[model samples]
Target: MMGQFDKNALPVAIIGGGPVGLAAAAHLIKKGEKFIVLEAGESVGSSILEWGHVQMFSPWQYNIDQAAKELLENAGWTSPDEEALPTGRELVEKYLLPLSNLPEIKEQIMLQAKVVRVAKKAHDKLKTGKRDTVPFQLYVEANGDTTVIEAKAVIDSSGTWTNPNPMLSNGIWTNAERQLHNEIHYGIPNVVQLENRYQNKTTLVIGSGHSAINALLGLATLQQKYSDTKIYWVLRKKQIHEVYGGQENDGLAARGELGIRIQQLVESGRINILTPFHINGVYPTNDKITVVGELNGEEFTIGDIDEMVVSTGFRPDTSFLNEVRINLDSTVESIDTLAPLIDPNTLLG
Candidate 1:
């Protein structure tokens, strides 16, 4: 039985204090609705700081939310150049941080709070009687202790940045790869800052996304300083050109420039590219990793790799929402209704 109280008095709960979560808060403020934001990191946009070195293809104008911008403007905040590209760090410094500091939002945010579970109060997944009348119970972990908070509604804007896809082509995690964690970097690495780890070394970068391209470009810069540095790129696409999105035709010039630059780099032959490669296994040999895979339908082994940057991609984590009934696409794992519109196969082709 649920306790009797004013359900309407409960505030809306927003998860993840990144851009989206903060934006939701701004919108709610505009609607005169009460809300609380729970952030897993020490501060807002903490995840963005991880890849702060990489610049985004989109500009500030496209990234800022209307409500957030309105709030910032009222608070005497100066906007960055609308057309200029901003690195992950710049995005946080110029936009996210400013928006989060607004008096209306700052006090409502709970930092270092991680939401571990969420469910309807006094009701399990199978229970439906009076469920709509009750509030949502969120189990949050922070400061080595767990606390339960109730909310009239919940917004899961927790992005997929922290949950990256595995390196194996078939999407499997093995002990061999786990043991070589020290030598393998999952996401983009700040090659310039961590020069010693990659300088004068042979590095393998997997995937054809923007992150992989960025990693290779950084390595290319290092190769200039240290002539012995070697770079290898691997992609599952049959032809390398497939990964070169719209190129010059893209609406966003910055994004198109990426395709142009990468194509030129590939033409230069400074980096080795292996396409249609399916990684079957990774093993350690003599303190180095040997990547066994099928390249062009033939079994092959790539050995003597000092480091690996796996920019494969990421997937959303919905484990906490197990008690909440929701529909997700089986393949894309996105909202059922949104899968058709956002599916990569539909958009890429």
Candidate 2:
């Protein structure tokens, strides 16, 4: 539902530089619309680089957006193997890099510009009449200076990658958890690159997803090099078998193998499994962080863990959009139609 506006007089403002934001830019350009892409990082696709070592489950054919592919193809760019699954590194280096380099897109992207606040020009949420007529004002802090920019409309594609869920079952972050920030890691870490950091340490992994499984796999590899290291996986589910999805039957070999490997690790005693567990709080012990939780409503404490990794999944940051009128599903935090099926994992956060 795009509004009719004069592109020359008031350009459309795009909020992120990731794949989705870039694809929107391609579409706007195809429609001969004037727009600006504001990226809050040093460069486009900065977030993708964080997990560059991880490979995607989807192949190249499913990864590229139609408009973006067309734009890249028209500019004499050759496509990669359509059926080959790409690692995050290869996706950024081979695809995103070339698309960003295109003159049409390159000229519109603004890096290191973070938008702090946004509202209708000279009007607050209370105002109605002529509010649509007045251009939207975006408060952007770039290079340590705050500046206001006007846009006919804004497309806030700021992704959910950066905002990770907390370890607590309630998801209400506490002071104790904040104090142990240095010990707790989120998302996938380049375990191979940080050999010294993870060597000979007991790490606790929370969640029953692919990410948690991958972290365990990485730690298992680390344990091979340094036999003293250990991995503990915690899940709130009634049964550990719930996480074993598709296995060898899955079309994606790597994904299927992930479940099989994790299953093997759990049975082989390489990774300690604690299921039907609910975390109440995270406290710091003398040498390690102590995880206080309940085992299926029975109080229990998991102590002396040197490190913790949370892979409970993602949630979008929409604090700045409070004044804007938009529809978002309360449960999934996504558009209503696309809301994910009731999470298969019984762990509620």
Candidate 3:
């Protein structure tokens, strides 16, 4: 089918099939440009499905891209209310599924296709002449088979879902932490459905973001039914009140309610909150997991944790992009051009 198009013309490549990647495809289609979307998962929005049970803080208006909205509207699809927030599942099923089904997009997207490497065709990093004209060579692996795709340009909206940051405050990956991967879960798990697993067990929840709050709240709910279960909320933040975000003054009701709910749980003495804890390491100690850290410039250790829920957030994976020449911030991992705009103080606000 690709042979039908001009052999001299290469399709632009978009490296993810999530909302941003799909939106890029729509815009490319509007401009009458050829493009292909490569998705690493089994289907579109596969990453979003991981948190499908959680409702988004933002409503549909801010979530949907303009190009995608137009594409769906042109297909006679009536969208959900702009003010109504949807869960991750609803976003995928009601939006991404329909967008992927569009002939313009469906035929161009490759599911279960993981991009392993990207580089300029017929040239190494050292070579320079005519490099701009050379198409990008993307090596994609699917079912153990590798295929090379030539793209005129690459729009990498691959995202950062797969690469979660560690709970260690020093920001280092230790050997001890590597062995505990099975015992620790990075994102929010369906705590409600895991009552049997967490019932009467002591679980530690890390990070002060909404992710941490959700995990703590879920475990607290579990504790209500099973009083033996204990929930610990740990963070490196100096002040616990900072995580509350905007309460009644917030525009988004759902986001504000999360802080309010978690604050109430903490005030009720349902959650054992720990802050300013600098995680030193996590390792096995006599068939039990031990979390060693620091608090108030003093050494501290917490043990007997049955399970750990880490909401430490994720970083963008640029391992494959090493071959591709692009400017990326050393710290935040965002595009170098936009990295300056990020301020940790105002970010949570």
Candidate 4:
């Protein structure tokens, strides 16, 4: 049960400065709500900065909310073309920064301010019987100084790009090997190090989703440049084309081009594609890592691999909200009860 508070005196605090958080800020501004946005990174759109080379499949039209669009237009902000799919950097530069710059929104932001803990405040009420505004102690570290903020609400629009899912490989790849070559698992874009790692060596990429496709295409591109890298793709699915079509087609040509390239690779024998194979375990050998797997009820071992990249999806970061007791789904995604979940809404807890 939430404790009663004097509604009029509370200020809202938004956690995260991503696109969703920015949209929430715009909404709060229109509603004449007092709020502050806290971003853990040095600037707004930190997630986009991490995905510099990746382009969103959603077009500019789908990308911008009506409130954001109207605010930008009224402020004489030039919008990107609806047909162009902006790269992560472009999206940050063209849309996020400008939207945040609006007088109503920019003043409410506290950049490089990470919220470490969110706890409830206990206080006495005045003669009105309403508790003095509940203060959510937001531990913010900015410019070498730490401060606490008391806010009426909290909104969490932090996207899932911060955490990358781990690749589940058995003992085939020893812990020591993984520690030694950690760069293979890092999601750095436009990198071409596969040739150096897999020249005349067999490489296996796990997962059948977009990340797998990305790895295959990236390795293919590297092979084209180096002319000596051998790559193999392993998936639990029966066929590669079966995983092709989805909602990826919006404005970016790279997604569709990647699908086409994947098909071509399978047809041209450049990539050895394996499907319906379950990875049972892995053990490191003298010459190569032994990958034990069951293919159609028969178990076999694949050895001599240079690297494996897992492109599994990510989960939202909501562990900080556990104490606040906000209603969350089984997957831990905040339930959209009313307004945004992280910033101002946290005050309700």
In order, candidate lDDTs are: 0.92, 0.86, 0.88, 0.71
Top-lDDT candidate index? 1
Best by TM-score: 1
TM-score of each: 0.97, 0.94, 0.95, 0.78
Clashes of each: 0, 0, 0, 16
The residue ranges of model 3 lying beyond 4 angstroms of the native Cα positions read 1-8, 345-349
- Quote the lDDT for 282 in model 3: 90
Worst 10 residues of 3 by lDDT: 1-10
TM-score head-to-head 3 vs 4, winner: 3
Q: Which is better, 2 or 4, measured by TM-score?
A: 2
Colliding pairs, model 1: none
Estimate, for each residue in 77-139, the C-alpha lDDT of model 1 and write its tens digit.
988999999999999989998888889999999999999999998889999988888889999
Better by lDDT, candidate 4 or 1: 1
Q: Residue-wise lDDT of candidate 3 within 174-202, one digit each (tens)?
A: 88788888778899988998788789998
Better of 1 and 3 by TM-score: 1
List, residue by residue over 56-173, the lDDT tens digit for candidate 2.
8888998898999999999999999998989988888888889888999999888999888889866688878667777888888898999898898899888888889999999888
Off by over 4 Å in 1: none
Worst 10 residues of 2 by lDDT: 340-349
